[model samples]
Target: MSKPKSIQVFEYSTLICGQEYNGHHFKKAHFNALVKLNEIHKGNYFTIGVNKITFKNYVGVLQVDGLVIEILPKIDQYESDSESSKIKWQAALIEMLRVTKRLKIKEKDEASVATQSKHLLDIYFEWFLAEVQKLIHQGLIKQYYKETSQVKALKGKLEFAGHIAKNVVHKERFYATHQVYDKDHLLHQVLFCALEIIASLTKGSYLYSTCKKVQLDFPEVKTIKVSAKTFEQIPHDRKTAPYETALAIARIIILNFAPNVKTGSENMLALLFDMNVLWEQYILVRLQRAQEKKGFTIIGQNSKPFWQNIAIRPDIVLSKGENENYIIDTKWKNIDQSKPSTQDLRQMYVYNEYWNSKKAMLLYPTNAISSEINEKDFVAFQETPNVKDHHQCSLGKISIFKEGRLDEEIGNTILKWFETSKNE
Candidate 1:
């Protein structure tokens, strides 16, 4: 029997691509997870009442301390030819990792992989640890820092106040900056904390032992958890370029590393990433890459006031010049087969009118089972008589199931828009 405390409940939704438990059969299971989660969050985060659980537009993982509950897409059993539900989720995650320049890990044979049983966190942990280990083997970067301290014996300068206060004045207080080299630097501190956390949480895994062995050399380095503010304090230079990737990975780990809770005799730690936000970031990254090759400028979330001086911020605005541009809003949800939602179209319409652009687009993730909505669905917006300057809208679908295609698909979609705008 599975421990009720360890169980996590998530509702199935088309917007996400994964499997979850739902309905009355798992009511007790859901309650158990929520009870523990609420306690961990101190009744602040997940305070909503759960009468009937149903996941909707949100496609992300929610975690309270060590217990994580992932919300993913429901399986489409009827569509046998469709890609495996897990494959779509993994592909999206892999694309996210690549786009962020976090890691270049590609999805290998999913059908017969030993890591098939591993969780998403495990995959990321393994990758981060491996990168850190490789960097360690090359030898941890060292830098010199000035050190000053009071000593029994005079090494440099003697303090007059200390000599008078001591009475004997045998021991001298020295004020001097001595250059020293060791693993007690800021970069080493972050790495050591990340490795320690991973080692503690992931015992028995290959990474646990590896981290233990690798961290042995840095005995003097004190482990310290870091936050966003911590990064601002850390010194960065061109010489530390090689440690950049490791530092970035370590920063994320430290920021998300939760406090451990005592559960029986063991301890629990949880770390989670918001997939919806990550997906948006991933899209922006791919769009930026496309911009580089195509020689176009794309502004993200720029505050542009509309009619009545109301402030508006659209996701992405692709511009050819001052006036020639199109509005793009990325929807992490799967579009319905029949048509785009009224609210989304209206939102885009507002953007188009305000920006003086004739075109707007709604981008969605395409899977094998997703219905292919055509250009006709956007005809209503184009046919509006009040609309001028060849006003139009488009529903674009990019395949998220196929590995390593996110960048290409998004680039192509934007390029096509550019072409269409030029013709107009």
Candidate 2:
């Protein structure tokens, strides 16, 4: 698919424990619209991603440039043809931002636009999630749910009344009342599926400083903040690109936080281990084996705009070299943190089927915090009837050490995978 024709950002909104909050507060929603939107999306019931739960720092009125995920603004305004946000969360976000006037970029004072505000940064996330909720509500998503309310007498005696009297008495009867619970299960399913892709895309964090290398100019975007002090401290030179500060931070994160890479494939895991670069970096490392021609392009055609195929993008397309090419996607989420709801594992299989890959692997972070699983043993768990019930398996060993020593740690692990593969 080509890029979406129209997109704009709006003030970001958030939900925690079932209440909506605007860009300003954390405990609850200030705006009625956001509250209504939260209910509509059932945000309380649906989680954002495993990483959202896994990675945490302090959050206040804003998402700091180096700390939280920065939502990118859309290029243009989109029309709201439907009252149903379920049909279009992006449009709703664009519309929502339009109401706030945060989406507007000043040609006159571009530098301030980049550094001064966090509204669109907020809107981008809200809009994206809203769009998802709308899609699930459209009825394309199907999941198993059964809940029924039981009608019982106030006292011990069972009560039966004639149809006419029953209406007056407020009587209802059911032989069985299975509690279907809330309708948000399907929404969670959708969110997690989207979450895996997005989380994997960015590795587990959404910090802009980690989005790209420092010094790389982000066109169309003015700035995204992860922290207040960082934002305030960045020099505001109009001639310099807005992301310059983010880029510089990204560099610090790279040199300090990420693993060391010696440029190409042999040492690319160093880049992949860097928490900032890991998301897209891991995907890139896997693609090194692909020939430009005669192979499936995991990211789609080179020209395909980045966000167009965000949801269903295949992880990898094995091409010419192998007899059987399989697509592989890595996820940083732990099923323990964000358990793999049926929808999650299903989407992984779906992508594999969509690309007609002979086999596929949904590579998880496999942290020791997760469990002590050896690689082969973990694969065997997949073959088990009820895999979720059993958490002890050896697929591969994964453990997390201090951030400073991460380079040495990750490098050793990658070396192990390479060695193990060679022996096999």
Candidate 3:
């Protein structure tokens, strides 16, 4: 089997006609698949132009037909299409996901993912395979499920209507509804379908053989068509709790899969995520981990009612010693410290006011080309003529990568900034 062609492009970058990027040709078929995908997704992922397709803030892998497009996050310093930069940013994105708990990588597989030169899709496929293998080793759970069928002998309760309708002439057959305890339930059904998809998509890749082996180990399950709602209808209990991670990954694979009935080769699978949400969660998780040791309490998406049936929430709120509260709003974009957006400033101001925080800071990720400004304070606004209370806001920069790796001490840095400002 021939390997599917792959292309690596940065988020918000454009792919034009006649462009061969990273040794992969941006062919017309690939473009057509993309257009069809955009139409299916209502143009949320990227915008299609006459001869070019420009990506949006989403960063992940999208495979259409025989082509795979891996979208890496764009850091200002690594704006160019350099192989080293691609590897760095790709690792950074995966690390962020792992930290945020979006991708669950076991400690044993961490080294494997780090050492291998797999694309994002392959990494995801391997993760799914690992989870399935673990479940198979530990044993897939069995549950009592209702099954209605025609049996030779009497079983559970008999459905008189079904019995009469189907077995009028055939008196030997009895139609009944029975409760059977088995591993062939909805959860395994979903996982089985996802494994089939992985088997098809990972062909000619390093994970193809392992995926096939895992599929062979999985129990035979009834093949049923599932939609997004089908996953939502799944019930969670002690028995189903262990399958959470596997089910989550399965949901991503099964839901995003779109098969082209006409040609069968233009099948599409997109696993894209909004970089903004990921950044916010990444920052929140890091801050909570770092501040837990201290006496500070960190809350994410802390919301309060602003109006009738409306609320205002900040990305993060840090409270220490009960009297001091600090607001942090994370932005994924790079901006001049001196020229923060008016809308953002107003939003921060509102957060400070509603949350009763003295200091509200707009936190941004810093890169090589970003401004030197670390934490620049915005002028304080007086509450009223008779009141002595004042509200202050600042624009702060946090370095996302340290020595080409994710900076795990970012929360400590922010804590230091708050302490220093308090002393002054």
Candidate 4:
């Protein structure tokens, strides 16, 4: 069964900025996540000693070591010096302190040290941030909440005397900086950063939650438990794992640099399948020229790998006119020709057989790891002494291309790949 939503490992955050700090309001997702963690912990309270919180729902008295989230009256001390000032103030804030066993609200504030405050919300947010900086030496909170002296109250030995009041305003402005959260919520910042890492690790190839919340917040997430057996299905040998292969397929557009407006997820997937084409010096030039003169057109899938047992997809299949076809794939990992497993050879061979037109290729990131298909890997195309080839071999004839140039250089190269290659 799925776990409960509230306690599930989630990206969380909160905001605390006021006009005084910057006449601004802001939200911090990272900050909120920390608060959520503290709330979910089961044992001793995470001491944010000496912090105070002032929220409409509570008057968090900042003690030396703990925070207490509770309600307090709006009345302020008109007389900060009279003997009854301390008692009267406590009496006014007492109703907010009464918390029993049945309440189910966001865990209200509970701090170790607080002076007192008029604005309850400010008190709470400050106390929360204070808990975040929990070293007795930090003294940011204890140093901040100095009491107001007026004497005549009781806490047994800890007699109440001062009527301390300090304003905790954000140093930064809370204007347009935090307006988005007030209007639409900006929690996505934390979620996006986290997901970006996952997407790279997964090669932009993991199952996502179809539900909006799940999809947006966790794009590279998979619910399945990864095991040794399941892990064995993917390429475990080189940098040619399924994800790298998949990513290679996804970036087919780079081959010719002509943007194809993919309509749906399915079309996008199909286009990626066509990206695996043999890279040839001539084909690269042809692709570049075609795009420069006339925008390139889409062709069918050309992911031919006579080397593997399973079907592999290329990112794009470029066409010069209605009948011509050339393939392209993206590679995010290092590409090396040596130490390749037999499976890699077999997969490329299979790709060649299935596509049948001629030419199969493997692509990879040259920046990450320097790799090249040495000239020796190339053999004379069966019947022709003049034509040469590589062992990432093909049924008809295959070419290989690794983009080691900048965008303009690669872009020009792809245009040429389209212009000169024979139409399939």
Candidate 5:
């Protein structure tokens, strides 16, 4: 007897439609993968709307019972019909992470070589774990607590409420209040939460040993379930500086983590991110840095009045002095090869009108067709297509893409764009 050809294992980066996933291997893994994805999304690092799409194809970065499957993205207006686009997905993801300021880059982490590996998902997970470990080595931050519990012997003070009733006969129960070492503390809980999730997700000995060591140090501490509200309860001070890095990583992990519902089932987590938000943040951070260097201010998510008592928020606004400003809205989608989208142009028109500026930009990710906008100038205007007469503002598409030097290239591009304001 031999294995059936139809029962082949799904390879890494494999693409399949929802209809084709009715087989045994996919069926067994489907529910669990969805569960893990939902769990991982709790961290707020990214979001996955698995329930939103019913019959469409998905690009896979899924794991189920040691089986990995990736769904390829469908062809789009800016995308080529070739299969190589799926291979380049890892590069796109790495590029996005490269611009993020929250995740510190380490030379030894080998992030530069992510393009060569199909296991990018695992690599990111390992990177996160390593960062957490490094922060832990700086000595885990601790907080004082006024702990009160019943003990066999005296510790702090006797609780009259409990000791009077329970110890009325033998007087054995002792209610005590004393600061004791335990895990419910936020710092220890963060480590414990990460340890638990990492223990289930990876089998690496280093991470496992680190987790065990943390458990030993905080022997009484337990995993404290965290949420957005949990962060609000945590206070920041001098002792918490080292915890900042670990706290950021911990928040991401804890937010995305989902415990297994059934006994012995695999846990779930999601790494899906909103490309729109990521792109906006990247542009905002770089633009702010550029503006600050030139003694200017960059305000993000600037809101303005619209018709019908409505309001609109432009993504990024660069200002020199109080009144003179430039508006830029970043779109994560690909640009139209011939011209910018009418809707995008109209949106910028509103931004320009509200800001009382003659120029506005609709920024998009780089496509196959490169625009003439360079890092030194960063702006090139085109006449609005439908504007037969006086156009409200000059609308243009600025490409923000990854090049050799991301930070320097992007910073220069932003600075150059703002420089045009001097002529206006």
Candidate 6:
């Protein structure tokens, strides 16, 4: 069998069948699979049009049978389709995920993989395999599980009813419930299930051999059906803590995997994430790490009741000393010269009043291809006639990339901006 055809598109881009897109056609099977996948996700990943599928804010790789759709982030809309642009955004997305603890990759392993040209999904597969290998090297943990079966020599408690029912014909066998201690338990079962999935999806990829080798080392545990709730119910302690990272990745792969069993041609696996939520998380993590040394407290999604049974939460709240507080809300989109939306402004205003913050700002990522809006001064709301104090909001932009690499100093840069604005 030949290798699957792969195509790349940025988030919010459209793909249609026939010769509409660079002579590449989107097969009806693939489109149908995406539609079904969207249905499974409640239509959050993409929107289906007449004959085309337009991706939404979610960015990641989606595999539908023989077609792999690599959806890159449209951080810089101008050069979104360029090869270099895709690599840059891919690296940025992966780095952000690492910082946010979504993807667990050590610094040395990440440095080695950073130089290679690989799809985001493949990179994830490799990372998961690496983690599983580590666990295997350290030895899989074992636990006691109950098993019920017929045995020639009864070693455990015999099931009287079952023995009477089954062994009535075969008097030599005993039906018994026994406790077996081994590596074939829930944790390993989940890992094995995910490995089966990876084996099916990663054919012809470079990571296939490594994945298969890892599977050989892994115990052949009983396969069990798992859901999001199944993962949530998994108990963690010193014995099972090492399985956390591998199990997390397995949950992602197993939950998103949609197998078309009838025809076996429409199977799809979607590992997409919302860029908006990612931006918020990335900002929070960066600020938390950077502000720790500055003697400032950074809180994320701090919520307060707004009205009856309603609450409001700002993205980030910076607190220093006793009475100084600042609010920063990160937006994933780029707003060049346009004024911040009235709804956002009003939200920030409320955040200030409720949090008793001295200042608030709408933080945005600067366009990678161009400089951001020049305004740095805060725009104050119209004060009431006799009010003793007023609140202010500003449009803040932080450069996302510097010299073709992710700017690690973004947190410090934002902190500098806050200090400068406060002094003025």
**With candidate 2 superimposed using the best TM-score fit, by how many Å does residue 327's alpha carbon deviate from the native?**
3.1
C-alpha lDDT of residue 188 in model 4? 21
Report every candidate's CA lDDT.
Answer: 0.58, 0.32, 0.82, 0.29, 0.55, 0.80
Give the top-scoring candidate (lDDT): 3
Which ranges in model 1 have alpha carbons more than 4 Å from their true place?
Answer: 1-83, 107-116, 146-148, 155-179, 260-271, 286-299, 305-311, 321-323, 337-343, 368-390, 397-399, 402-410, 413-424
- Per-residue lDDT tens digits for candidate 5, residues 314-362, read 8987777777766788766544645667788778777776786655667
Per-residue alpha-carbon lDDT of model 3 for 1-424, expressed as tens digits?
5556888888989998778987877877777777887888888889999978999889988887667888989747336778777877888888888898777666465546535656677877878898899999999988889999999999999999999999989999999999899989999999999998888877888778999899889899999898998898899999889899899999989888877521245567888989999999999998898897766799998789889999889999999986899899998887643468889989988888888888988888877532233334545755668767788888788778888788888888877777777766
Q: Residue 210 error for model 1, in Å?
A: 1.4
Candidate 1 structure quality by residue, lDDT tens digits, 1-424: 1211222223232211122332113333344454464467665334334443344334334433333355444223233323354445545555566567655466563332224444445555676777777877787777776556556555554556654565365443454445577767887777888887777666655456666777675546855657788778777787788787777777766665545433433333444444555666777777877786676787888777665977887788888766687778887655645568888888888887778776777877656432244444344364557644456687876665435333355664655655654554
For model 2 the TM-score comes to 0.29
Q: Give me the runs in candidate 3 sitting further than 4 Å from their true place.
A: 1-4, 106-115, 260-264, 369-378, 382-384
Off by over 4 Å in 5: 1-25, 31-64, 67-88, 107-124, 152-157, 181-184, 204-220, 260-264, 292-296, 304-311, 337-343, 373-408, 414-424
Better of 2 and 6 by TM-score: 6
Which pairs clash in the backbone of model 3?
A: none
State the TM-score for model 4.
0.25
Per-residue CA lDDT of model 2 for 238-310, tens digit only, reads: 4334334323323322222211212121111011111222323443443442334333434421221335565
For candidate 5, which ten residues in a row score worst on lDDT?
3-12
Candidates in order, TM-scores: namely 0.72, 0.29, 0.92, 0.25, 0.72, 0.92
Ranking by lDDT: 3, 6, 1, 5, 2, 4
lDDT per residue as tens, model 6, 64-149: 76567888776556654866776777777778888888776665655454365456677778778988999989888889888999
TM-score of candidate 1 relative to the true fold: 0.72
lDDT score, candidate 6, position 320 = 88
TM-score of 3: 0.92
